[model samples]
Target: MAAWPWKSLARSRQPTDGGDSAAPGKLSLSLSELFVVGTWFGVATGLLELGGTLAAVKLMGRVTYDTLRTNWHYFWMTPLSNLVLFSVSALVLCVATARIPRLRTGRVVFFLYAYLTAWSLVSAIPTLHKTAEVVLAIGLACVTTKFLTKRRSTFLRIAPRAAILGAGLILAIAGVDVYSTNRPVDRGPSVASVAAVGPPNVVLIVLDTVRADSLTPYGAERDTTPNLARLAREGVLFKHARSTAPWTLPSHASLFTGRWPFELSADVGRPLDSAFPTLAEQLADRGYATGGFVANTQNCNAWYGLDRGFDHYEDFYENATVTPIEVLRSSRLGRYVVTSKLAQAVIKRAAAPVDFRYRKTAGMINRDALAWLSDKGDQPFFMFLNYFDVHDPYQPPKEAERRFTKAGGEAQSAANLARDAYDDCLVYLDSQIGRLLAELESRGKLQNTLVIVTSDHGEGFGEHGLAGHGVSLYRSELHIPLMLVHPTRTPAGTVVSEPVSLRDVAPTILDLLDLGTAPTFAGKSLANTWSASAADRDFSEPVLSEVDRADHVPAEVEDAPARRGRMRSITANGRTYILNGDGREELYDLHDDPEESNDLADLADAQEHLHQLRELMEQVTGVQENGE
Candidate 1:
């Protein structure tokens, strides 16, 4: 009868394996005994990996369980999972290697199997690539078993110990990383101390990726934003407004903190740093209930730390529930099988008939906003709402889609299709805006609430070789609509053409509410514009927009020596100067070439303007003029 592997390991009293001892004088383990030790090594390595991650997260602090659950797929619950997987892989490899009668031969095969299995399990995709990796692992295991089966007593005993020691060193390094990560600083006031009384409600609506030119108020050929036009009729519109960055996250960070986008740490996978004070924190400290409802999951999700200081932050994925079994599923071999190309094709074919409706649409967001407003109970509120309908891959409702597309339209160009879809989304968003305003008016909340509508950035449709934002500092991505409506309606329909930065939004909100600006704010308050004499008003401060090319790079290249090339655009004195990372410059006369089709960088007459804008860029970023 065959002896159980563990029992065999226990009965072996002397070092019989044909190798030297792990230490100089210790007895060398036999084949079966070595199997037990190898299994321990694998399990220990796995446990250390998983434990380290958990410890790191705990040390970081301020992370809620819901946030962990929402972001769990990013890690696949790696700690306990690694232990289980490594233990099983070790046991299976040992059993297969045991077929070789020679302890020395079996040891070599076992180590090879272990190495291959571990490498195969490392993955960045849950697709055919994973299947290929697992197949390669199994192939290596089979070959190791077949070719290295000759039984011999002469083998080096030190190899196994060396590998085990290497793993231990790796685990120690991982532990250091966990303990060394910087803890986020606590900045805001405690929720318990917040008073329920002072300041009028402030509503900041960010129209994600919507360019100023797309709106009717900005002279678009299409009536893309009639509701926005209506707001413009009763509010102040700034025609030359610009975003701080050509993307959602950094630009929004600038809006919230009233700082330049360059001042914030930009990492899509992580939350915003807790060191900066947010506008919500400012308001909450002065007795305002702050809430945020955003549709952009990539940058605005609560996991990203943008939810700081808000009394309530609603993200579509926040309520998703993850079971313990679901956490373990990613570590299983069945995951590879289920994610195989054949299985995926079958699933896609089967599910083709089911229409998937987007959960984070403008209507759904407005519904939640209305519900939140109903429950506030007269406490002054600060609300931030972001509508992502105008962003890329724009798919509006069927009615809107049909209206934008021809009734029986033949094949259209990609640009036309994109444009139509974009316009349709704007129209749909406009309707939702109308609904939101009507609700506020009906509830009599409009009379006393200050409303500000703007965008984080704009979208591009293949202009300057870019279809989306974050790649360039073009006007298409920087130019955004900014409209402000006062509660008392003193300066109705005033148009401010001087270039203004999105960073100004926070200071303006505070200024309008009679709240003194926080010392940390870097933006100038536009509240003075209402009362400042025309000559005293300073439009000389350049509106700066920046772009980080690193943010636009694909995830596959993340390990590449982070080549973070940054670009800055300066709009001042009716001219726009875009300083490229490679020291190239593009100058556009905003009045003569709003489309930016003509670049006057080489024009001799424009040299002084270029030099001035270049200096302004350097002053803003604190980087030298030579692309330092």
Candidate 2:
């Protein structure tokens, strides 16, 4: 019926005279020439795929150019990684062909090159139909193979030059990226001079995704945070501190600006707007050296506007120092291959020794912060540290894990194992905190520093049928641990039982430092709560927490009430009123049901309280229930 595709190559491979020229309609290549051509072809394919993926991601508006530039290493790393992968593949094919006389026809090599290139290009186009992608890839491969056969000499002649140019371009880009990202920080001249004896150096440490109930200070059975317990004993601990939101970005934004989450422009895929001045910005304006050391690069990076006022900001790089596997993950082809379960397992095992941790651990963050601290001159400083080890995908160090979990704990149910791993992470994080505090004390900075420790938001582990933050506005996610340690201002063993929102953090910090509040700050300062006598304490402001509609809904909760719209809760007078998105309301008495197991929304006696809460929410937020 039909002749095999490689028959044409077989006819063309007949013995050639001892020169580069081949007979008309016939092709011949020495082993060296075959390898060079194949390698160049592979390199070209890689360049095409790289360009296509970048263009597609850009066109979809998923990330900004500034983000790519700030993280520029990935830009050059991906192409170089692709080049190595494709070149090795070509070399292997050439060697196999040389070993087998029957494979010398070159049709198999040409088809593979065309197919691989076609597949890469197709994959780069996001949301394309799977069936169409396969059909297009195969059709393109056939056409490419035919063209390569007909113009074999032209392709062979041009490949080496192209490969050299491509290689040079990648190197040039790499040089530029490295230089730009590593430029020295811009520490502008002090705008305002400080007094000889100014306020204590402010060190705000945020334990990300840590629930109040998980720590010993909040009555946890286990001593997951002995250092925090010590701090609570020596500092002013807010017993009912609540986050303004249940997620990282908004909660952090509120913490910095002393404003509600909806009042700011921080949301999914949107960076915090620079409308309101941040605590660091205000502190820097008053001549404080500000530095931010964060382990959660995904949400806490400079690209997200969290680094607006910091003179020095350290974040985790995608590939701190290049390793082959990290480079592979940066490429389009490697990403596709790793989608297969078997490939993922193999790659995970291979990459364990090199890049096992998803983000920088608490110890690494401490190391960088300590280094920065040691380098500071005599300026009063504002140091913000974010520890992210307790966030998710909990994988604690072996030593720390052993303290909380057994060796064969993976055999437990997924939820139980996750909780165990979470506790293990907390143990590791607490140890790091203890180490940091000890180091600071040794350096003579602890006594003079105002150490304010808290969490951005709490985590959810089967609480209210939720397993993560950002999906619900329950106590498990909103309640956070807040404590401030100062040698003179805060007395040891002081605890405030009044409910407070994280929105008050910035104002309180400014208030404590004797700096005037910005005009745009919404929350009242809590300085009086800790500093004033018990009879003068005023923490009457209602605490409000809001969670916007989720950008993505997990399949398990597709039909849940949380998928309806935004949710808001108001906590006051030891009572909580939840206004759910689907027009449902829930009320809980904190004194009777701390776990919120019982709801009093439908109780006739609670109707007046619900009405009062709704009125309070409307008055505070200036929005009615009907969205008027």
Candidate 3:
């Protein structure tokens, strides 16, 4: 008997030509068969990967020229990498199957081809990696049967011809695609007329779910964000900055368009209307190269219309196309064969804890940002970066988590541990920010860059019966840290206490660049307020923050009625007026009740202000009291 069951199984098979089959324990791939199988495997893998990547791009609605140009390497490199990996796999499988007495049969080759096709299809769908492995196992089982062993010679003769034809067709299509993508077309005078005057590059970094109070610069007792504090010293800080909405979608909409959320059709799941010009569109029209690097996979993705006018939009979550080897290595049964014992031991001892702790942390984000920055030419560029590090599921790196809380401590409650993790995430984010700044400085881009640091909204730490954002219009959820660092225009150590809304960000950036704001913009430019005398400052307008709870509800909530429970909060003159959609109102003197502990709604002096603010909300959103 042979040393292995497969070798014995090979010897058990009868020779088709009545000649002696291969002797026991002597099964290996001949040079000629190896050449044919290896070439066929390479060509088939390349073709499948290219075809699948193009299909995935179409499915993702990212087939535009700009997207293809920016992500060209990803499309080609991923497939070529898979081709190399699958070639090695094919060689091993070929050698093993050659040991069979029916080695001259082509069923094994066809099975390898089928398996490669399955891998290409499933690898594009990040959720179906395990499914591909299952398909391959079933294919192998069928290929090893007696039925397929009988039809070997005829199958072998036909497969090579079919593979060559398929390869040629695929290569031709791929070549045409490459040519079309690289071919330039007329962009018209609008693109040509928008010449650059060496304006400062703009970098808007949104720290998702980061509250103003959590940062050291914002009076947090803990040193949660030392880098941000240093950044504040290098520019100006708006102490009373507020987001237009208490969530990612509408807040980002307002920030990009300089329009109030209600001014446009801004809501979750609904793409922003093309009629509303985004900051990127405006900058792109003005000869500025625009790029977006967003880590918030849920809200600020391409399907949500945040990719408008970005020459290069690289969302980390959009990296769904991986190699088949990755799929096999991740599979349950394949893990026993694919991974080495030393690798398994190291992963168990070293990688497991770190993997459990951090999930695509800010370090990866900074690396991508730096790479893009290196590619961004001297043209004035507008880069929109959204970091999800400070968002929920706050699993900071083990080192960071250990700095704040113990692994198995008494404070293991979800809320307490989450808060500790949140702080650690902030520290980790600060380090990333520091690294980004260093990279920019090293490249001499920092001096010419206008860095705007802010957040979509703040997280709720069980305040007002809320643990996250987007559900309420409370102070903790509306308040955000807004800081600006400009080389020549913004003076260092400048603090602006006047109330400001994030909707003003777009107009302020355009205003600084001398690019006129659009007539449709609801938010006025705050350029004068950036560094103006007390007399020149305009502090009359109340900063409005709103939350449309009905539109923002989670999809899992079944049988949820159309609550129409939209709430709007307006702050002016140290007072906040909240008009809950059901004709109820609350007033708080933010000066004395910063935590919003005291409700002064019934007071006669506060009623007039509350009524005025309610009228403003009604005028803005076109929603009256009594729940719509």
Model 3 per-residue lDDT tens digits across residues 428-515: 8998898888877766677778899999999888776566777677888889999998877688999888888898888888877778
What TM-score does candidate 3 reach? 0.67
Candidate 3 worst ten-residue window by lDDT? 63-72
Minimal lDDT window, size 10, model 2 = 63-72
Best-performing candidate as measured by TM-score? 2
Candidate 3 wrongly placed segments (more than 4 Å): 1-197, 318-321, 325-359, 398-401, 549-564, 622-628
- Candidate achieving higher TM-score, 1 or 3: 1
TM-score of each candidate structure, all chains considered together: 0.70, 0.77, 0.67
For 1-628, candidate 2 gives per-residue lDDT tens digits of 1134445555455434324464423343556665665666657776776566455444433334223222325667767766776777767766776655445434445666677778767755545787777777777877887788787768777877887788788878877876775787554432323323566789999999999889999899888888889888998999999999888888999999898988987776567778999999999999988999988877776656778789988864543555556566666666565455787788678665334345778888888787677656457889999999899888775556557677777778777788878888999999999999998776666767888999999977886777877777789988999998888767789888889999998888887777877777878887778777788877688799998855554556554345668888999978998888878899999889988989999999998988898888898788797454
Instruction: Score candidate 2 by lDDT.
Output: 0.76
List RMSD in Å for every model shown.
10.2, 6.2, 9.3
Q: Judged by lDDT relative to the true structure, which candidate is superior, 2 or 3?
A: 2
CA displacement after TM-score superposition, residue 406 of candidate 2 (Å): 5.5
The models' CA-based lDDT, in order, is: 0.68, 0.76, 0.68
Query: Clashes in each model (backbone N, CA, C under 3 Å)?
Result: 3, 0, 1
lDDT of 1 by residue, 1-628 (tens): 1124324433544344444543221243355545544545454444443444344434443333223333223243343344344545556655664654343334343444444344434332223475566555555544543433322232234445644565555455545544543344333332222222345788899999999999999989988888999888787889999999888878988899988877886455445786789999999998888889888866776666688889988874322323333333334332443356775677588665322223367887887777666667567889899998888778875554445756544488777888888898998999999999987776667777889999999977777656666667888888999999964643887888888899888988888888888878878887656557898876465588877656455553333111247677899988999877666798999999988989999999999999988888888888786744
